[model samples]
Target: MMKILIIEDEPSVRVGLSFTLESKGHKITTAENGLDGIRIFEREGFDIVISDLRLPGADGIEVLKSIKNISPDTGVIIMTAFADVKNAVEAMREGAYDYISKPFEPDELLIVIDRFIKHKGLELENIRLKEEIRERERFQHIIGTSPAMQRIFETIEVIAKTDSSVIIYGESGTGKELVANALHNLSPRKDKPFIKINCAAIPETLLESELFGHEKGAFTGAVQRRKGKFEAASGGTIFLDEIGDMPLALQAKLLRVLESHTFERLGGNESLTIDVRVIYATRKNLKDEVKANRFREDLFYRLNVLPITLPPLRDRKEDIPLLVNHFLKMFGEKLEKSDLAVTPGTMDMFMEYDYPGNVRELKHSVEMAATLCKGTKIERWCLPAEIRGDGETPDAVISVFDDLPLTERVKTFEREAIRRVLEETHGKKKEAAKKLGISRETLWRKLKEHGFPVSPSDLEE
Candidate 1:
């Protein structure tokens, strides 16, 4: 049930609204004037406040402003006479959620109230989810509050003590390495070494030496004996990233190591006993690779013991705001812009865009925007061209442009376009000019006309 406040100068109207709302399973509070309603609302918070357009002491607009100032999320609806519809519209602009005219049936007002309740329900649930996510935001550099991420976090904790091989499956930049680290950090071997190596980054010719270590003179460059990742990570955890890209020959050797506690160093027959745990991450489907004869079936099955799949950024949109806040704070501190903030448009775009590169792309985007921002606020123009689009105007920008004359509006828009292009090109006039479809001379002319901070150095570039 909702707590509703009704403000009407007419005693009968106030009484009628309160009775009607109470009958619909709402706890109603009534006031004969706007001031009394405001007092009661402040004393006792409400889910909604219904006020009359014309009232003594303060009008409905004043009441709306007061309600919003106190509680920004509370729904406010204005009641107006047919003749005072203009005032009702004005009230809406002042932040009234909706308005209904006098002589309306109770059903009409009830419909508006019902819509507000439903919308409020969703908003409250969103707030709850965010709060729940906040509690787990810094889960060892991995962030997720959504059910998808929470389940993964739980799984990580549940299996932290086990020494099983974990194969993380996710697209690039989905924090696979972070998961590996968490597994090591929370395991019984937390105090031991946690070595990481990228199989795909190291070449095939040197991969065997990298994984199994090598004796002196094993290769032309190997002048001295060196311990491999597995040897170094003994009594700890070894994370093998992009193992799917490992050559078939290397796969067989790795499979041998997985099945045995001892491995031989390159160019040496002596065996070395191992007590290290292994973790693997890849973006490819190993079963398909096995079918294609690019990966060994035995190794795939052995490494797939405790698999964890990380959801992509698009699939976990609920985490975007958390991730954005994280990156903004991180980049803001690095750039020394402590109070960094984003415009509504920037956040709106962040929520709507499909981040194909996952969290890494989002991190880079926030960093770029923070660096390009003239002030603490990251605007829609500060976003990458691909995310915000070069020609797209966000609602906030459209509203600002709506107040300008046609000619001046066009001039201002051009000025902003030039500024964004220049920022993206790092003050390089040649590239910015080309992006704007103009030459250096035209760009320089427009920059001057737009009151840009152009100097002799600008022309040289």
Candidate 2:
């Protein structure tokens, strides 16, 4: 376990971070101010020191200097507000490990910590975390390790370099916008502006003006001649979210712009050409919409160059623990419970219950539990009524781990989780391991350790 020190003035934020890290099996210590944080570091060394940029006593930079003076190898992470980002970046020049913005998700910070830990263990010569930071700038929020998600990541990496128009398909709350951001950030237009417009949210009467811009006196609200999203995103990226909701006339206009690379503002004959990369996202199936004559067939074909489908949370049950940990830390910070934990039974309910709203539902569930629970551990009762109301979770699941040692309890939970996945795959060990985000060899060892037969045929029952 890594020893982590949190130095922040806010009690809720400090406790929330402390709880999140502690839940990850790390030893965590907190100081209310930077001066005390430096003194604590002088007495007790730590693997990482996460300090807020501003403090009552010595500031984060001072603490960083003292920590580096004491132990150069120790990683120092600066926590800064949006305004102090420049100072945080400068700290990297002075031997700080990394910097995270205030109110950042717990999982995001964990990714940086994990990256540092991996390098520290390998004793890498260069400790500059800029590359990883760059990688996450657009892609950091996505959380998943299932095979389906892995394939999506690979596809994004390959297609992001090209200026291909991407069509992302996913159920609501499946992170379609995040994928769009990844494509834009990872592409040549990384330095360019990225503008997003939701087609469904705007009225049909104004959708054209919003996308292609409008001239003064073009419509009732046209007070002044203004640029549209495409014009504003010149030589950049324009994400047309909910494009499926675009009317047929506007769809034809969008198609013309795609084919001819030019468009005219509403009530204007003058044509404007733009060099903007286009990305579209939708929760609806365009093919079906086209068949129904709701979406234009030509527009559908134009936008479907490179399609990316995000799997729902239920399909990747193995990633629930990671997602839960992320949400726990986030809500814990807001709720001021740094020692938060979910009971094994409650976790089982979480894993078993299918999230119809996908990751968004799971995130909200964690938030609700964190808000209601008075103690560090979240119990089954703390869960939202809808989850508990389903009443499908087995009492036996909780009873099995009762009074067991911590390690034994964890092992039992792992075995059950693996068994469920194996059953889902119909005894296909390869598929099961991929779903579990583990190597086939590791799965084989786990099967044997859990008193399961090695033969795939044995799992068929």
For all the candidates, what are their Cα RMSDs to the real structure? 14.5, 20.8
lDDT, residue 431, model 1 = 96
Cα-based RMSD of candidate 1? 14.5
Roughly what TM-score does model 1 have, to 2 decimal places? 0.61
**How many backbone clashes does every candidate have?**
0, 1
C-alpha TM-scores of all predictions: 0.61, 0.57
Model 1 ranges off by over 4 Å: 1-134, 390-461
Q: In order, what lDDT does every prediction score?
A: 0.87, 0.85
Q: Mind giving the per-residue lDDT tens digits that candidate 1 earns over 1-461?
A: 88999988888888888888899999998888888889999999998998888899888899999999999989999988999877887888888999998989999999999999899889889999897756665358788788999899999887878988899999988989889989999899999999999999998999999988999998898999999988999999999999999998888888887788789899989999989988899999888999999988888888888899999999999999888888999888987889999888789999988988999999988987786665788887667767786467545554565877898678757876887787689778989998999988889999888655577776777
Please estimate how well model 2 matches the true structure, expressed as its whole-model Cα lDDT: 0.85
